[model samples]
Target chain A: MADPIHQFEIHNIVSLGSIGGHDIAFTNSALYMAIVVVGIAALLVGASSSRALVPGRMQSIAELSYEFVADTIQSTAGKEGMKFFPFVFTIFMFVLFANVIGIIPYTFTVTSHIIITAALALLVFLTVIVYGIYKNGLRFFGLFVPHGIPIYILPLIVFIEVLSFLSRPISHSVRLFANMLAGHITLKVFASFITLLGGFGIAGMAGATLPLALVVALFALELLVAFLQAYVFAILTCIYLNDAIHPGH
Target chain B: MATQAHTEHPGGKPQFPPFNKETFASQLIWLAVFFIALYVIIARLAIPRIGGIVEARRDRVEGDLAEANNLKEQSSAAMAAYEKSLADARGRAQALANETREKLNAEADKARRSLEAELNAKLAQAEQTIAGTKTAAMANVRSIAVDTASAIVERLTGAAPAASAVEGAVADALKR
Candidate 1:
């Protein structure tokens, strides 16, 4: 069987010359990322250009996406959090489009990669830290201290708090990356099984049908997971950003 | 050398190239580029238009509701005015009926009183005429009785009394 992992291989598409003595070549990942950006821009911009009071199908879809992200931010972060609406909205659309696009046959799932997810998580992490400190100053550190803990348990609790606090980005990134990675891999494996079994004989072909059915179900599940992961990523960003907005609670 | 090693890696290891350190720069660079591009597109174009549409719709709905409420109030006021006029018309009609009733009653009273006065005058005149005829009847009766008394005297004793004397006798007898 062919390598299922082969689907995720990044190829250097346009080998741009070395920049600052390092290979800054445009890669397949980069091409798709550009496509994601342009595609989202085109869809949203083109849909909204008519500015119809009674929106058409594309306009409704576009508007729904805007409303979805807006509601997520408003619910998690409140009115004050709306100042960062553009950034939060941008990231949600970016991740959501990437995930949905990745589900297409033979397409690379960008969010499945640890590097990309970690980078997205890192951006949220930094925003929380910077904004927290900027807004709350020293009180931002107080997030580690539980309000009602007894004096003896306070130190232990604080230690756990600090530990968990440090692990936020790791969990946040891994949650999405791991789910996509595992789901895609499982899909690939099952799809391969159908081929591997079908090649054996007539009886093997009948047996292959089960794996084929499973592959179809897994595809549907992955589509749901794609949307779910984008939502999780966006909401987590909101929750973390809330800590920045409100330092104590 | 690094590129060769990456290419040579076996599939059994599940070699995720994104995890490989060599590609971090490229992914990060592209992530930055496209993300900023998306951010700019969304911030500048998408938000303003969508937000505008939503806000405008809300404002229009509120304005329509307010206008509806105003119209409702005006209708009620007009209804009240109509009701007041209806009541005024009814009162005026009642007053006119009362006036007509009073005038009819006054005219009936005047006619009845005059008819009663005229009838009373005619009864009194008829009474006076009957009294005069009775006096004439008495005068004839007295004369006839006197003549009859004289005729009887002539036939029985061959003596006749005077009419004056007979009348005086009849009168004196009547007086007694």
Candidate 2:
């Protein structure tokens, strides 16, 4: 049986050179990332090439993705959040395509890595801080201060609020990364069970059908998780950005 | 498999692939590069085209609805004009029938009155002619009775009696 953890190992495709003590090289993760980017670009660019008044299949998907992201932004962040549409839209499509592409057998799951998801979550976190300060100036600190709180416990409440506010990026990144990592690992574990059971004989092979069925069901679940995680990530980004736009509530 | 993973990495012992700090730089750099590329493609090309299509369809549908409403108004106006003409025709036909009936009734009245007057004139003339005939017959009857009485007296005496005395006696008998 194949090692479940072996799938996550990043291999160097090309060595770019070392800077300081660290080696900077293109790896399989980078390759898949490039594939995701190109795939998204080609789908969008090619689908809109015809600009058909009545959309064909691919164009319909392209339009649906666009409207989906737009609606998510509008609902969570309101109209003023539209200025960050490009940024939010990019994050949504990138995570969504990366996740969906990773579901295919033998493909590297980009979102499964902590570093990648951390980078994405931190990007959202930093954008919220920077844009909130830029738009609201010192009033952005109002995000940590609640309205109608009594003066007696205000200090403790402020401390807790700051702590939770700081933990947002950690939770946001871990939620996606853990979901992908665990789902893939479980799928591999169940798949290996089928092989282990089948090696016993014809009766063992018959018993292997149970795990096979579970793996099939898990695959379907993972597919849902892939879409759901992307949605959660995008919506959370919108919510965080909303705090920037409207800091108090 | 664990031993293979250990050999796969060049430095020291192999760490868990995700936790390995060695490759973070490459992933971050590439993620930045590709994310920026995707952002440009989506913002520059995809949004404008899709937004334009939706806007155009909305305008077309609104225009079609306005034209449909205009046609309905025109049709209702035509129906009103047709109904007004129908009412006018019905009123004119009723007036024409009334005028023809009145003329026929007046002519019938005039013909009946003239015939009644002609019959009355004829009846009066007939009554006058009968009265004159009756008066002439009475005068003849008196003269004949006088002549017959004188002849009877002369025959009984074997000679003729006087005519005035006979006439006077016949007149006196006729009066009685």
Candidate 3:
């Protein structure tokens, strides 16, 4: 059976040489990221080109995605958070397109990498912290202090809250990274089982149908996960942004 | 898998590809580049266009609704005017009919009263004539009687009675 991990390996498309003692060559990962970005740009630009009062299919999709993210941000972060709309929209589309495109065979899963997800999560984290502090000053620390806690337990509660607040990025990034990594690895394993079983001849080929069916079911499930993880990432970003805008218990 | 990666790369690190530090900077650079590009595209191009479309549609619909409401109000006003005229015409017809009826009734009553007065006047004249005729006839009868009485008296005496005496005898006989 082929190594499932092999598919995740990055290959250089162009050798850009060392930058600050780090390898900065353009790789398949970068190529796929470029594809996702260009694809999104093209779709959006083309969809809006006609500007029909009554939307066509492509336009409908564009509008629906825009409204979906808009509503999510509006609900989670309130109107004040509309300032972060472009940031949030970019993150949502990036994650969504990366995840969905990764599902296609042989395409690099950009969000599957810990570095990528961590980068995205850290960006949101830093933005929240910077904006919260900038907008709210020291009051942003109120995020760690409950409004109606007993004085006796306020210290412990604040400690826990601080710890939880600090851990947001870890959980946020890991949730998406782990889900995609595991799902892809599992799909690859099950697909390998079909090949493994088929090598054993007629009975084995007949038995391979089970893993094949499992792969199909898992494939459908992974598609849902891809969409769900993107949504989860976007909503969580909104929630964190909400804390920045209105920090309280 | 770590050993396999180790063998595959021979002296390189055996870390999982996802956790590998080697490509982190490259990925970050590309991520920043593409994400900013996407943000620019969406913010500068897409959002404004979509928002404009929605705004335009809303304005159009609201304008159409307002126009419809205006037309409805005008129609209702016209209907009210039409109804008022219709009611006015109906009242005019009623008043006209009442006035004509009253005039006809008054004229008929005047005609009847005049006819009654004329018939009464003619009846009074006829009664007066009957009274006069009765008096004249009575006078004639009285005279005829006197003549007959006088004739009879003469035949019995073999001589004509005197005129004055005959009249007096006739009057006495009539009285008796």
What is the TM-score (0 to 1) of chain A in model 2?
A: 0.98
Compose the digit string of candidate 1's lDDT tens values, residues A8-88: 777788887665655677888888888788878877888878888788898888889888888988999899889888889
Which is the winner by DockQ between candidate 1 and candidate 3? 3
With a 3 Å backbone cut-off (N, CA, C), the pairs that clash in candidate 3 are none
Clash count per candidate: 0, 0, 0
Cα lDDT computed for each candidate against the true fold: 0.85, 0.88, 0.88
> Per-residue CA lDDT of candidate 3, range B1-176, in tens?
53345334535656577877777888888888888888898899878887777677789899999999999999999999999999999999999999999999999999999999999999999999999999899789778877777788878987888878888877787678
- Weakest lDDT window of 10 consecutive positions for candidate 1 chain B: B1-10
Worst lDDT run of 10 residues, candidate 3 chain B, spans B1-10
In model 2, which runs have C-alpha deviations exceeding 4 angstroms?
B1-6, B103-176
Estimate candidate 3's alpha-carbon lDDT, on a 0 to 1 scale: 0.88
Worst 10 residues of 2 chain B by lDDT: B1-10
Per-residue lDDT, model 2, residue B40, is 90
For every candidate, what share of the true interface contacts is present? 0.66, 0.69, 0.72
Least well predicted 10-residue stretch by lDDT in candidate 2 chain A = A1-10
Q: Show model 1 residue runs off by greater than 4 Å.
A: A19-22, B1-14, B124-176
Q: Which model, 2 or 3, shows the larger TM-score? A: 3
